[model samples]
Target chain A: MSTTTPPRPRRSRAERYRSALWLLTKRDLRVRYSTSALGYFWSILDPLVMSGIYWFVFVVVLDKGGDIGEKPYIVFLIAALLPWMWFTGTISDSTRAFLREAKLVRSTSIPRTIWVARLVLSKGLEFLASIPVLIIFAVIFGAQANWNLVWTYPLAIILQAILVLGLGLIVAPLVVFFRDLERAVKLILRFLFYASPIVYSTLDIPAAIQPWAALNPLTGIFALYRSGLYPEQLMVFPIVMSAVISVLVLGIGLLVFRRYERAVLKEI
Target chain B: MTEPIISVTDLGIHFRRNKARRRSFKDLFAGSARRSRPGEFWAFRNLSFDVAPGEAIGVVGRNGQGKSTLLKLVAGVILPDEGRVRVNAGVAPLIEITGGFVSDLSVRDNVYLTAGLHGMTKAEVAARFDEIIAFAEIEDFVDTPYKHLSSGMKVRIAFSVIAQLDEPVILVDEVLAVGDKAFREKCYGRIDELLSAGRTLFFVSHNERDLRRFCSRGIYLDKGKLVLDGPIADVLDRYNADYNNPTP
Candidate 1:
């Protein structure tokens, strides 16, 4: 309505991206902790509690394997669960990211990309918060401390983030058009838990189907995680592949997301 | 003299509704025939307006009118279907008072977050933090989660944060109707301050009193087309006359 020129030029992509990421991360942290009495403890406790349940199932009930060469089953599960939690959390949260913030999407003129980026970054922070818990579990179990573990651990985290963000961008917008996609994603994630190498190793799959297992992005990510938590094992190629696939999925997902972004806001 | 800060020419928006019979799964494989519904519906057609720096204009109409749609287009929240909006100045839209605030966040944190989205640096917000809180009159609840606050509290906090921004042009929707009378008066006072400082304001409201008090000029939009644009008193009189006497 007012015709005065805005003081500055259009914001650059880097500026918008950084601002969006910061605002989203701040909102996530503030909102998550604001109402709760326990606050920051929830971040560490969620993964720890989930790991305990899995420990009871895989280590106690099944007793399939223990401490792959010195790493306790609890340590192994915690390590893998940390990244898995991040992946699943990001997928679920980012799926509803745009829809849940429809008011912001409809009211303010901030770029829509911020919605997806914020959701991903906030989940990434939660994943980072769980790292200390993973390290503590490793220390208690006397897992080996190798330089390879340090380097590979960060690589796996980055890959998991990309894969989740990419998948979120692709699926979240589709959710606006097909309401059933939300339910389908939940069902698929449940199916993928067992399909993924979360509870067991890719080796458990018959050798004839091992190639198909490699196609699951989580398979490569978990394999890399196991290798880092226990450097004695070999998971180099799987980690590399996971990183590559994550980048590709993210790139393609962003393209699709941007293409449909205008409609997504309208439909929602 | 400076160029007009806001330029909109031949702006139009249409929403299309699809009424084709959905194909069943079996019919999909069998290539069953389908019939299409009516074509697109025009929400607004061939609308044009311009605003100069430091001008205060009011947009008024009844519900189901295209006032909100035009505001959305101006704010860039939604794109215009057929035409373009060229905004030369920064925009601060108060379309939904608490649009940016996450109710789960504390008032203080929401202020920082909202300011950050407006491209304000953390340090700048920090400098204005106290002033914003004081203006909103929620000093005691600044640290509390916003979700726990009453609707009035939320609006107050949101308005306070918005008032601190240094944008050249501000777009205000009818959300000011939510706050208490005293608070609403304060909001108008703030707008008066902005106008006195030579900032342009585009306000949309159903209240004639607000339009008369805050705006120097008025634009009447009926079904997305501008019907009248001129001095506030004359435009409002014409709008009232047109409303009182409808064309058959």
Candidate 2:
């Protein structure tokens, strides 16, 4: 009963992947905010609440108000802290990005990299929305904003997004094969929180440990953010290091993801 | 004769068996050397076939006979380990009809989302939106979250969306088992329409009646090997005879 007919033209691979990425990212954001009353508020709420708590502990509890800098403790803490929330949130959630969508991952022909990319994009958006909170605090706290703010903020965001994407790409696929890595990722994030310059300036660190702290890619990115907020304290080394390290991390991530792409189906 | 639209040559796919067991921290702490080695199990091996355009192939198999795995391979969902599957036509797979729906999104959003995943462009989905909703017959619940809808409703929406895909090759895996008589009959009509339009098809089902009704060719699989391939009647006859007269 069937007759042969000519085939229709199809879209190119790049076009298909781009559409898939957009659709999946939109779906992720919608589902995330659908069930809760707070909706988009939750994205910024975590960092906002954490910044407030940390400000209390450092200034009121520890009486270190004068030592932080000329900037208010709240403003200084959030400059780097907000971006940290974006990075850590994307990393922790990405470990389960593949495993959570086991059904979609196992059944569809869409690229596996879509999962990691969607996580980065969605978290990156939330991170972007939270930026105004930093700006509002900076303006209110009389931060020494200047022309340097223009380049530093965008550069810091782009560098951080690249760094998180690379890390997310590596972890998303690896966690599928190694379930223990999921729990291990959380512990590592906690260690990294204190390890990076979230609460204290890198300059405050003992000269001995400053070298070791500079090795973290985020250390440089966050330092750039601090520099953007307070121009006088801007350090050039970390910004250049961040730009270089971000590219290296992205390259490594792409290699690791491609190698494990085919093997991931069976594990999932 | 024209070339086959789909060809499989010595295809093989295997999965790791001890994945979960190897992940157990207790086993690692206990130093159980035997459990540490992950074993591999072949889902299928050395499978080769060519499907011509406009051919509807029925895949028959027992549980674990790798019927779904073959469809997955054809759909490009899973890659083969040993050989290759080459298809000249774009395939529209109907496996796990409601599996891709996001529960929190309304039925309308899911239609767009699932259709987009199946390779439909945004403008295409937008153009066919009303037709899809009308076919699904869930106009009143269009805005209702997918999770709140009845299973039958979900199946109808999923089927309606996929039925509109213009891909030249179609893969179906028992998606007709859901919904009421009216809806099942509707789906059957749509499949008939696809076949009449000259689309190649791979229909996997354990139900012999359904297979015989929709397919002229049959491939019988047993224990991950293709045991028989011929006319639908001949394959079923041999398959039933094997069951009735067990060689001792």
**Candidate maximizing lDDT:** 2
Considering chain A alone, report the TM-score of candidate 2 relative to the true chain A: 0.93
Stretches of candidate 2 above 4 Å error?
A: A1-9, A232-234, B24-38, B245-248
lDDT of 2 at A209: 80
Q: Among all windows of ten consecutive residues in candidate 1 chain B, which has the lowest summed lDDT?
A: B28-37
For candidate 1, lDDT tens digit of each residue in B12-118? 87654553333233532343112222455667778887899989999877776788878878888887766689988778788776888887676777888887787
lDDT of 2 by residue, B1-248 (tens): 78999999998877777666545445324552222244767778899999999999999877777898899989998888779999887888888777788888999889899888877888888878887888889999989989998989988998887777768889999888889999999888888888888888899987788888889999988877889989998888888787753222
Kindly report which residue stretches of model 1 are placed more than 4 angstroms away from their true locations once superposed: A1-13, A66-71, A231-237, B16-40, B139-141, B144-150, B227-242, B245-248
**Candidate 2, pairs of clashing residues:** none
DockQ of each: 0.35, 0.41
Top candidate by DockQ? 2
Q: Candidates' lDDT values, in order?
A: 0.77, 0.83
Residue B26, candidate 2: C-alpha displacement in angstroms: 14
Tens-place lDDT per residue, model 1, A35-109, is 689987887787778778877876678775563223487887777777877788778876788788887778667
Shift in Å, residue A114, candidate 2: 0.7
